[model samples]
Target: MLDIAAELHEWVRQGRDFAVATVVAVDGSAPRGPGATLAVDTGGEAVGSVSGGCVEAAVYELCRQALRDGRTVLAPFGPTADDPFATGLTCGGSIDVLVTPVPRTSPARSLTARALAAAANGRPTALARPLPSADTPEDPRPLLVHPDGAHEGTLGGPPELDRWAAHEAAALLAAGRTGTVPGCPSTGRPALFVESSAAPPRLIVFGAVDVASALVGLGAFLGYRVTVCDARPVFATPARFPAAHEVVVDWPHRYLERTEVDARTVLCVLTHDPKFDVPLLQLALRLPVAYIGAMGSRTTHEDRIRRLRETGVTEHQLKRLRSPIGLDLGARTPQETALSIAAEIVAVLRGGAGPPLTGGRTPIHHDAPGRVRRPELRPPGTARTSPRNR
Candidate 1:
């Protein structure tokens, strides 16, 4: 799946046949959500995970079986009435997993390689696969949806059903969200389990400072499409920010105004200068972005707040700013500082507190509404990303 695209992409290039198991549904307390993948090559080498650790062995065997038989399968992993110790989730939740084979000769192999390549490189793409069932059609089965209303493959359904499913996947891609929606309408659409994999979210850094480079790298590692913007063309060059997906020389506020953003966008104003920070933060604090953090000392923050207020920024909007960005980890180096800031971004994303978990009674995990969860991430910066997104 796209989560392990870097490795899976290589598997395709080498013409190695493989089977993939994807978590398609969840009932309760499932550690991994829909779209979580566990891929196994013909050689029995595996990458990625479907569950935290509960049902991996069973899922692994299922993938191996799929590779051998070349049959798409949908299996459930949960507590069984006769055997409580069977392959199931220990977290008291149930999940439905779909195992699909990607043989070298199958058209799906090529289609999957394309989706993986696009998603790995931060291009806006989503892969939608219908669960295998009695009415399941033959090969070239999955539907590939792009952000610009373009689609590649088909669900082998009626034209109307394919169009409708592609539309739904496109909407999910626009939001940078992946999950199960109503699948192909195969004769009343029998509630087919659909699983979608979308590109990563956005993390826009509004400064070309030394720390910006580290932040860009970390953001990509955490699965964000990173951008660096500044008004000075001299500072905002690709040579300076090789980690950034794109480097813009336009004014921070001006560039933001013309760009696309959503609820998942993270804005980091690293340009402490009032000329850059004030106007940018004023606009950012009011947008529907996920986090708005500005870099400045306490004195500079107070001055910046005063300037923002003078620009008609209301108290409600000002309350959203996270100045003096990053957690209080006594960080000094740019890498440490970037880690602290990235930690805070994740905290905000997951509704988590900045306190230590040493001896707290607070729930260890907080789930933000509609927040998409996945297994461990494969750092995007370390991979050979396609140049298309750049």
Candidate 2:
């Protein structure tokens, strides 16, 4: 639904009318989960996908018709009694979609638009839908929450449904995950799809010098919204850290006083100076940031840990810090070191053991664009050659 919400906002912003098709139910081997949405604007532009290309064209035609008629309708496409392949979904399952034409200003449309605006401003939001009682067994209602507590709409149903969703939303906010809740009808279970968004995690590099510059560059490329903080003004110039979103030339601990760190944030102590690193480590070890990595040798790490313990950082708290800052990739150069650090961050965020893809089965992204995107290994500064040519 976050994908649908974002794309629908884009569609309307471009001066187009569109209709959304949502899968309300599925019986058999459906490719997508229920609550899956596909929106097609009047201009034939589409975002979000319903089926695996088998029913997109048909869904587009329906969207065009709905836009013309200004009506909201439910479409059941599958092996119905009259036409099996008429709807183009022949995957031996049924998909019931709520096709709602979005007016320039309608209730659902307004809610989604506000939700998108909140997400754009790095705010958290939730979108809730009331499930049909008779049609499905799963608790069909779900609220989509963002990282900052902003949400789109609500289930407008009984207070019980809303309360259950709010509880789930809090959990989703904490974990930054999206999924469905089942058994909400007093069974204490509900089927829902929850998607969470947080501010792109922070990567604070404590040095503003050469290695810091390389790390900042790599961090930005990896989507960390990098910040470079150093007490030294000469080296912490924006020119030195071009890829950094912020360059702070202030005492590291003092600067952290004004910043908020969450479990999603990463604090990297890159300066080898005890004056900066020790104080910054004090603050970082006390915070809940997911990863506190310091760039130092094994000896430096052990020494720092001992000093931290002396300063009342318990072993439990000190466990959060990752000394040496990256996997043992045997990297020797600045660029290679940056790669190792970025890879470690990725591994942490993904909650994986950094294994090869051959062992993984989860989709690279949930409801990622049907359009082919380049793999993560594409070289920097290289154009992504389209897959169509191959």
Candidate 3:
């Protein structure tokens, strides 16, 4: 339900009761994964989606039922013979959904409100809801866990159980993921659905041009806090890139040096000019950003690399730069070019090769390895004072 946090927050503020259906598990080719939510308020209003479109109607009805009865219900939908006519996914997948009523007076409502508020303010927040298990009665009270290891509400299990669940949820929150974890020892089943809503990743676009404007829109749509920076004040205006979260009139390198970027950040240098590109490329290559692509032709790329190498950038660092920016999509317009760049960014993040998936041997989804310790959890540009800092 954290996906529709803003709407849920407003609903709670207005004392409006609602029901939420969250996907707790999936099998086969389910369109939506765990943590996908479909919420319906008392007024028959809805926000968010649990399935791509297949089982929304059925989930909506389940939500309404939960709202009317003020009871939590676990509804399983699949292509199986059981309740086939009631709800079946055409994608040949199965999903278990937990529909819970969120009355204004319930502790769940208050916990959800706090989680939503934290997410709205760009804070790392997680919501842990106890799913029903055969061994023990499910705890209806959801726990709101923050990055600092503090939590509100409780699972009503042993204190150690809550701590264990909170620790696991914190690990998932650090990775900006949402999914289920094994239940606490008392529950004896995988009963906790940890939904993490980390702050949006950063997208810093250097050089405010037509392509930059298109990229800003695409980046924002992809849930990035996009910033368009350029030294030329006339070119870098909020009017040109209305979708960007911020537009800065500053040198790209200087701005990047001072900005709060993390390993999840994506830097796109579109300035093409050596004065702006070289210094920025040097700094970006050394950082641990997820993507660093510079827009230029092959000749310009070679020239930029030569300059970067001259300025003490190592061969290993230069390899991280993706110059001649995007995939070869034969894009001729600014919007199409932006799409190509966005596609490349997504490909990099998901460890996908920018190639046709048809009849390909590559797995559609890459299984990410175990989480690695991050240098710091604080926002970029903040000092890494933690003892764990590398």
lDDT score, candidate 3, position 190: 43
Model 3: residues with Cα > 4 Å off, grouped in runs: 42-44, 68-71, 79-86, 120-123, 184-191, 357-390
Q: Report clashes for each candidate as comma-separated counts.
A: 0, 19, 1
Expressed as tens digits, the lDDT of each residue in 1-390 for candidate 2 is 454666666766876677777765554546765557788776777788877776677777777788888765555566433453355454555555556677675556666666666665666555544433343433232345444444434565555665667676656556554444443445533344444444577888888766677889888887788899988898889988879999998998888878877777888788866777787888888887778888889888888877888888888888788787887788898888877877787777656555556778643323322211112222367432211111
How many pairs of residues collide in model 3? 1
| lDDT: worst 10-residue window of model 2 | 368-377
* C-alpha lDDT of candidate 2 relative to the true structure: 0.65
On TM-score, the leading prediction is: 3
Candidates' lDDT values, in order? 0.79, 0.65, 0.81
Q: 1-390, model 1: which lDDT tens digit per residue?
A: 776778888888898999988887666567887778999998999999999787898889988988888888777776443355566776666677878899997877778889888867767688877665455664338888888767887777678777777777777777766666643333544233334455557899999998999999999899788999999999999999888899999999999999998888999999999988888887888799899999989999999999999999999999899989999999999999999999999898878888998988665556566744332122345321111111
- Top-scoring candidate (lDDT): 3
Question: What TM-score should be assigned to candidate 2?
Answer: 0.70
User: RMSDs, each prediction?
Assistant: 8.6, 10.0, 9.5
Candidate 1, run of 10 with poorest lDDT: 381-390
Please write out the lDDT profile of model 3 over residues 1-390, one tens digit for every residue. 887788888888888999989987765567877778889998899999998887788789888888888877666666634444545676666677878889886767777888988776667899988776454454377888988777888777678777877887888897788877754344443457788999888999999988999999999999999999999999999999999999999999999999998878999999899999998988889897889999999999999989998999999998899889998899999999999999999888877788898988665554334422212112367431211121
Question: Which is the winner by TM-score between candidate 2 and candidate 3?
Answer: 3
